[model samples]
Target: MGCARWARRAAPARDIYLTYNWKWNVDEEICGICQQGFDQMCPKCVHPIECKPCVGECKHTFHVHCLDQWLLKRNICPMCRVNWVIFRKFE
Candidate 1:
């Protein structure tokens, strides 16, 4: 089976929750966006941001403000060039 099909089949049963051990106090060392090592701020805007890893299907995580600016120029994801779908709900 193809990777995408495999991912789709497995996704429904997978738990997406992220858990951390607060006993070690490691939150300060992790990046909120990519959930990896500490990321540096953008020099142009002075906003902290994490760069997505090169290998992945959905490596499009970014700061809301920074990504908004980026999306203005292109509709596809910066890292993967995959078209993004926007959904807005009215409450």
Candidate 2:
């Protein structure tokens, strides 16, 4: 709807920068589906040491495992009800 803004500042490593930027727009620091912090291991994490987060086209974020489980039942995002596509993925 409007011009997209790109930050002029040099970015941190991608995973760090993207995750940190999301914090400002988020009301809660938890994944909408699993109710766990993005960096914490939710019950849904397939591997204990690696809980990647995925950002959808709607800009809502979720633990990848949680979102995968969700996508199995419905294609829309649990937070925004937008058609969920993996727009950006972070490790």
Candidate 3:
């Protein structure tokens, strides 16, 4: 009779490395245009604007549409006279 040999295989565990870059700015809870708290919908369109964009220079939050309307008349931030300078890192 011939003897049979069996071999066992083991799986190796892999380690994953992840890196992330996050940029966050503090935003007020109320929309200046609507005068409504973030928990409420935009007063103009009656839509949610949570996490809505804010003026980087002043940290003021506003509904996108609302800001658009305001921007039509002026190029500066509504709350601040600061020119709307889009942020970018020059190389």
Per-candidate TM-score against the hidden true structure: 0.33, 0.63, 0.51
List, residue by residue over 7-52, the lDDT tens digit for candidate 2: 3657576554442323323334788887888646679556434777
Ranking 1 against 2 by TM-score, winner: 2
Ordered by lDDT, highest first, the candidates read 2, 3, 1
The residue-by-residue lDDT of candidate 1 on 1-91, one tens digit each, is 6776657434456568985432211223433333443344433445232332121135334434445666688876665678744332111
Question: What is candidate 1's local distance difference test score?
Answer: 0.42
Which pairs clash (backbone N, Cα, C closer than 3 Å) in model 1? Answer: none
Model 1 bad stretches (over 4 Å):
1-57, 86-91
Locate the minimum summed-lDDT window of 10 residues in model 1. 47-56
lDDT of 3 at 5: 47
User: Can you tell me which runs of candidate 2 are displaced by over 4 Å?
Assistant: 1-28, 46-49
Query: Residue 48 in candidate 2 has what lDDT?
Result: 38
Question: What TM value does model 1 have?
Answer: 0.33
lDDT per residue, candidate 3, 15-73, as tens digits?
98996643233357666776765555565664343334444455666656667687799
- Ordered from best to worst TM-score, the candidate numbers read 2, 3, 1
Give the candidate number with the greatest TM-score.
2
lDDT of 2 at 24: 24
The ten-residue window of minimal lDDT in model 3 covers 82-91
lDDT of 2 at 75: 97
